[model samples]
Target: MVNAFFLFILAGLAEIGGGYLVWLWLREARPLWYGILGGIILVLYGIIPTLQKFPNFGRTYAAYGGIFIFLAVIWGWGIDKKIPDTYDWIGVAVCMVGVSIMLWAPRH
Candidate 1:
């Protein structure tokens, strides 16, 4: 459980951080190196989930969506200087509950 969450965190950071770098290079016009590094990190983001013990690809990625959303909110708050409003917190809570159900539900 803890290991799974840790992996999720790593994946989220890689994906979001990489995307941000690409966005900076393209939209913000930072530099080409930003995009290059971002692309590499994005590749890492894709590969990180495969290291998980979970065998179900569908379930693993599905649960990761929830973690991604939660992490995105934090990333926006910290990196983008966007404070999450009440609605954002509510949505994050819903995502967390959904993730818990999807990942931790007992098999039939």
Candidate 2:
């Protein structure tokens, strides 16, 4: 569903962005405020998944792992100025298929 995908993307961005900020603070020496804001956003990332309609926590987080990979690739490409190679695209495709199957496949 649209809502589910949106939530996944939102949560992924929160996690990635938050972590990136913290990375900048500690690794790249950006600022202390960067780490503080990143910590707040990380808290939000933890809460966002609870908004999903899926009842199974494991399934939801498992599927989210795939989404997170996809988003991380995009983030790296766009923000880090790292162009993805063919192997990266292949990996993203595989992860996306796995995510779709896990999220949409029928159950007894």
Clash pairs, candidate 2, are none
Q: Which whole-number lDDT from 0 to 100 does residue 61 have in model 1?
A: 98
Winning candidate number (lDDT)? 1
Which parts of model 2 are misplaced by more than 4 Å?
none
Q: What lDDT tens digits, residue by residue, belong to model 1 across residues 4-101?
A: 99999999999999999999999998989999999999999999999999989999999999999999999999999999999999999999999999
Could you tell me the TM-score of candidate 2? 0.98
Please give the CA lDDT of all the candidate structures. 0.97, 0.97
Model 1 — TM-score against the truth? 0.98
Total colliding residue pairs, candidate 2: 0
What are the per-residue Cα lDDT tens digits for candidate 2 across 1-108? 899999999999999999999999999989899999999999999999999999999999999999999999999999999999999999999999999999999999
Instruction: Quote the lDDT for 72 in model 2.
Output: 97
Taking every candidate in turn, the Cα RMSD to the unseen true structure, in Å, is 0.5, 0.5
